[model samples]
Target chain A: MTPSHTAESARRSAGDPPPAELRSRLLGALEGLLAHRAFDAVSVIDIIRAAGVSKASFYFYFASKQAVLAELVRQAVRRGHEAADPWVSPDAAGPSDPVEGLRQGVTDGARLWRENAGVLKAIVESWGSDDGLRALWLDQMNSFTDAAVTRIEADPEALRHLGGVDVQATAAGLTWLGERLYYLAAAGVPPFDDQTVLIDTLTNAWTATLYGRRAADGRPAGGAIVDGHEGR
Target chain B: MTPSHTAESARRSAGDPPPAELRSRLLGALEGLLAHRAFDAVSVIDIIRAAGVSKASFYFYFASKQAVLAELVRQAVRRGHEAADPWVSPDAAGPSDPVEGLRQGVTDGARLWRENAGVLKAIVESWGSDDGLRALWLDQMNSFTDAAVTRIEADPEALRHLGGVDVQATAAGLTWLGERLYYLAAAGVPPFDDQTVLIDTLTNAWTATLYGRRAADGRPAGGAIVDGHEGR
Candidate 1:
């Protein structure tokens, strides 16, 4: 894996586009390195060595390690949107009780964080310092915020329940809330590190804030879910 | 301020300890630098030069720039606890409605973040890569989480309203939510950057999650606070 002259020989003979294959290898190597090392501690030299590519090839694909990190963050954000679709998508259908759909969505989102913890962690830790990374992060966050705002606004019941709370601000706050919780969960911080409890807590929060109070049976006033206790 | 030999003249002769003054100078220099540059960009040399202190004096007071950062974070967390007391303190007296106290606390917290934005930003950006900073950050977060849990558990009304939600985990999630929101506001991120909306949104989320549904008039079902519109 740590060879300098193996890039040409290691290429698969399966008619893979050479340039795309090399780029993928570099990306994969950086992602793999980030699993154990912080982005600051991981260098281009280390990435290429791990990718079994030459310095020239590594530069040909990426201007710097930060560039590769930006790409990883972009990919992760796209996957994050997909994972959140069950709850954030305005037309996505699910259980009659929307909170149950939310639970499922949050559950999937937590799993996504665990899988991409390395890449996400690097971006969260570095974005504040780098101009490009900061812009990219805020832009990605806005997408989630907009999706959440749209979903909530589309639900007249939820909208009526919100009262004086500004939808755009609340959506933005909730989006940041999810980001922080997922970051803490990925970093193995306590309470948040407990996945079951984390999901339950977030689902409850979302239900309460967006759907208003639940009845004694743990169902929203308008909800008729048969068994709230079954999932947890 | 940039003179190498000015540390001697910069000291206040008001019976302040020389060592303490020098340490404070170093800390202040680093904090000021952080406002303009990320921690990764601020070096020991930069700190000392800004402090107008010798390299040996810096090492004598603190082990590294990171050590100084740890101290700043500690100081900030202490101030944070004071700012949060109106809401998080179980025995703190307030308006007939507790949510008013929560609003005041959240507003103070936002101000605190704005004041310490530079130092707090540095910690958030570097903690993931530095083991000591990560531990310090997590420990400080746990203090907030514990206070939240204690406050929630003490309020039987709030407890009753929580339903199946786990208090400990909910407190942890809300604590991180506040941290993220404050960080974004301090960083001047949109939506959250609007202070009025930020405070109102957080107050609403806290009110709903901890106090359950508000009445049609915007007061929680359990209490009476006239004119919810007066503050906003």
Candidate 2:
């Protein structure tokens, strides 16, 4: 098994899995509620009511509303990391075109963000004020950066050109950039229009930074290059 | 005068300037207060008390506590725009080395953000929840982006290579990226350490994006290229 898979298995083994059905219901309820309102405005009672779970059951697995949101963020971060498989997975064969591989990774990452935009938005917006959320979000960012550093270290050619760049810091800065940009887009901020613009513009920045060039070829670098199904 | 200057002058003309002494007192009070606490946690009463001004006097010049914060944001934005003179001012003459010019701009911008880090942080963290603050912040970002776009458009060589890049969108994205990065740095978030790392990493990204290359020369890009005294 790959190191990443083993790591995942080890993580899973370390913790008692939440009663899957109740946890799923709570998460789904939070997601549904977040789709319409800001997270700060949502209350624990609201989550319990939406989940159709008793208060006692709500406390059975989680400690607070923040804990539930933290769990949701943890899931989103895992999904986001997994979606970045095109670039981060060491065992996965490198794309025939390196730049295109970077673009595909960015595109997939954007798609995942868009899909979970609500929960992701909550995490981004609330983290500044909520210590628990902030720690979870920071952990996620570091994990993504760690994955990026690993990918860069594994690829000799990419590593050569990144001589002066601080690999860890660059990865961290870029990761935060993607998060903030996608958050702004999801929150309906200006200049961050539809998904296509968000995806393309971000892919441009990522490709430029990592590959040292623009995605000039008009080829659609979204789906064809990366095996989108592997992570699932 | 340019359109932006005309707009600024017009804005100045629209309102009777606040009594210099009272305004200074209030601003100083707010700055002192913000140094210790989050903007949201601070109240209007706190400002008036700190300023040693009557409630009526506070209302005479400012509409709310938010108005005070908005004014601070406006001043910070104007200072930041001025600090970007090295890169954005068209008739100011481009630097001898283009990449160095870009680096200097990034460095100046970072310094301004660092100087007013507290107010800037308050604006960033609080704006997400407040519509008025959000609009003010968005206006600041767009103005910065407009300046960047203008700079890029004025330079024929940079413009040419930016063919695939939607110049305005690219500028806007980079501008937001800079804002978020600086915000993270100013907020003391992890991986964004001392001023050197912040300035260097950001300079690298800005130089790469605008020039389509890194700042390869080892020359000091901070003070020599641009008249640091121009904006002050």
Candidate 3:
């Protein structure tokens, strides 16, 4: 089967909106190109050629190459939110232990980043240079931070020891930390690319910030999870 | 006085090499432009016009706009290393408390990024897209990681609790985490710009990963610093 077959399968499985066939095709082409080349170096001609679409068609769906990138970033954000559901959803029966739930979230988030390294790398690298992309990324970060705040607010006991910490700002900082660390790791930046180290380091950070220690044994008094035995 | 006159003053005070006047002019121009616009958006004509130099002269000291960025990144790295001197210098009498030394390093590093936000933002945003910039950043990261490794190696007790963690990978991960977090903060990315939250969250992460807890109060029993009183 051809490459469009994969896109078609993904589209069908995800139940994309009607009339999005061409848009998905263009996105697929951009993804294919970005897989092997830096986003800045990939031009409109390259994207159209890779997508097997005409210039006019590309414009019909995207204002410019950056628009396409913004769209890709939007999709990445959606996937990221979905991946974070296991941990962020307040009602979800997440891992019995809060720390385990956070670790699971970190693992899933890292996997999502590894899978979409190309688009994520482009989005991260374009953070400051492209306002549209930056805004899109910032929007996602805000959503993640909000979810983190909710998580922390819902479980005051889990974070009671972090008495003076500004939960909102703390959530925001940790979310950005995760975003940057994962971007660096996914982009194959040295030292960050090692999956085990990257994920564990991130989990450790998240746990320490939210749970107040690296492990249950290391936790401070009154900072223990409700069901610490479930973590293992 | 002309802009170059100011640059000349900065050069002399900073002890820049002699006969590098024009080069400094172009760099100053680039810095001025970057402060107002993104690096990729700034053009060669813009640099020359801002510097009051001609095209040929622009090419005299730098091969391209990216070359100017590389120089700025190089200088930023040097400044970073200098800022990190208190923490990374092998022979220096660093903070008597390991956590205190780490906190001092994080604070100084954050200050350096805040001071050089414009150029550092460009370098970080250009990371992956430009080989030269990426190499420069990667080199700085590697050096930071090496220094971190050395510190950890030197402090067997402070980090003994982290027995299972890969110290090298851990160091690399933390270094990148700092880089990305600082970039976002300096670039004024939402939720990460709060100095107090960002630094404390980062310090918490670093401390947790290295010493296994959020603070001296929570530090693993056997992982106490040689002189905890000095930290206060």
| Residue-by-residue lDDT tens digits, candidate 3, B1-232 | 2433553233244444366577887888998888878888899999988877779878888998999999987898798887786687644887777787777788898999887888988887777788877887788888999988887888875467565455776687778778877877877664467675567767867886777556433234555333211110
lDDT string for model 1 (A18-93, tens) is 5568788889999999999888899889998898777998888888888899999989878878777767665657
Using lDDT as the measure, the top candidate is: 1
Where is model 2 more than 4 Å wrong at Cα? A1-26, A48-64, A217-232, B1-26, B52-64, B91-94, B217-232
In model 2, how large is the Cα lDDT of residue A43? 89
User: B38-72, model 2: which lDDT tens digit per residue?
Assistant: 88778888987787676888888788877888989
Q: What is the TM-score of chain A in candidate 3?
A: 0.82
DockQ, all models: 0.46, 0.22, 0.30
**Global lDDT of each candidate:** 0.78, 0.73, 0.74
> What is the DockQ (computed on Cα atoms) for candidate 3?
0.30
Worst 10 residues of 3 chain A by lDDT: A218-227
Tens-place lDDT per residue, model 3, A104-205, is 788788888878888988887776777787788788888888888778888866456555545676677678778878887877775567665666677767
- Identify the candidate with maximal DockQ: 1
Model 1 lDDT on a 0 to 1 scale? 0.78
lDDT of 2 by residue, A1-232 (tens): 2233321232244345444556777788888899998887898889888877778888987888888889888888788776776577755775777677776787777778778878888888777777788788888888888887888888786676666566777788788788878887888876675566576677777667766677753345553433111110
Interface RMSD of each: 5.7, 9.3, 9.1
lDDT of 3: 0.74
lDDT of 1 by residue, B162-203 (tens): 766667777887888888888877777776777876787777
Question: Runs in model 3 with CA error above 4 Å?
Answer: A1-20, A215-232, B1-20, B90-94, B213-232
